[model samples]
Target: MAGGLLGTDVVTQIGIIVRDIEKTSQAFADFFGVEKPKWFLTDTIDKTQATYRGEPCYGRAKLAFFKLGNLDIELIEPDEHPSTWREFLDQHGEGVHHIAFVIQGMQEKITLLAGRDMPLVQKGEYTGGRYAYIDTVPQLKVAIELLEND
Candidate 1:
C-alpha cells in the first residue's frame, strides 16, 4: 500500500497467461483495434538464469506486449517447464497471472514481501532488466511481479 514496500504504487504491466499467444494477441488487437503484436520467445536459461522456487529452472515462454497509455498488456504462453507462468496456467488455467510494478531495489522488495508471507515464486533476467514473481494470491488474490530495469 505504501512506497516503502514497492517503491511505487503505479502498475506498469499486467501479464496474462494463455495457451496460444498468437491467438490471444490477435484477440486483444481485434478488441482494441490496435496492431497485432508479434510474439517472441523469452531468453534461454543461459541468458536469463531463471529460477523457480530457489532452484534453477529451464522454463521459457512466448511473450507479446501491447502498450496502451502507460500500461502494457503482456500475453504469455509458457512451455511445459517449471515456472510461475506454467504453474499458474496449470493450477488456475489461462487468465491474469501478475500485475507488475517497476521498482528500484528488487532484492529488498522481494525480502520485504517474503517477510509478509509473499514468497518469491520465480525470477529471471531479460535483455536490460530483471523480473520476479511473488506469490501474493493468499493476500491479494493475484501474484505480483517486480521489474527492475538497468
Candidate 2:
C-alpha cells in the first residue's frame, strides 16, 4: 500500500466544520451554483469509544455531502464530545478540517500507515466507502485518510 500511495486518486474532498449546517450548506450551494448537499446527522450514530493519543474520546458529528463532479465537498458539524474536530472548531470556528483521498484498499493502507507509526485517529464505513484517519500532523488540527469502496 505504501509503495502504491502515489498511484491512487488525489484528495477529493475538503471538509469544513460549520456551526449552522443548513445555512452553510445553502451558502456552498449558492457559491457553486449547485443543488443542496445530502445531510447526515451522526450525533446518535456511532457509540463506540475510540482512543486518541492513549486517551478515551467520545463524540458524534453531522455531515453534509455535496457532490461535485466525482468529488464531494463535505461540511461537518461536530456534536458535543472531544472529537478530532473539536479543536478545529474552537480555534478556527467552522472551516476546513480535513482532506479525504479515495483509494482502493483501505485496511491495507491502514496497516501501511500504522507501520509508519501513524495510528488511526478514527475509522468507519458508510454507504459509499470505508475510511480511516491518521494524525500525522496533529498540530495542524486536521486528519489525512484513506477512503475506499466498501
Write down the lDDT of every candidate, Cα atoms only. 0.93, 0.72
> Which stretches in model 1 have alpha-carbon errors above 4 Å?
1-4
User: What would the per-residue lDDT of candidate 1 be over residues 1-150, giving only the tens digit for each residue?
Assistant: 577578798999999999999889999999999999989999899999999999998999999999999999999999998898899899999999999999998998899999999999999899999999999999999999999999
Flag regions of model 2 displaced more than 4 Å. Answer: 1-7, 43-58, 138-142
Model 1 earns a TM-score of 0.97
49-102 in candidate 2: lDDT tens per residue? 444444565666778998888777888888777767676697779777778887
TM match of model 2 to true structure: 0.76
**Relative to the unseen true structure, what is the Cα RMSD of model 2?**
3.3
> What is candidate 2's CA lDDT for residue 114?
75
Alpha carbon lDDT at 103, candidate 1 = 97
TM-score of every prediction relative to native: 0.97, 0.76
Clashing pairs for predicted structure model 2, backbone only = none
Using TM-score as the measure, which candidate wins? 1
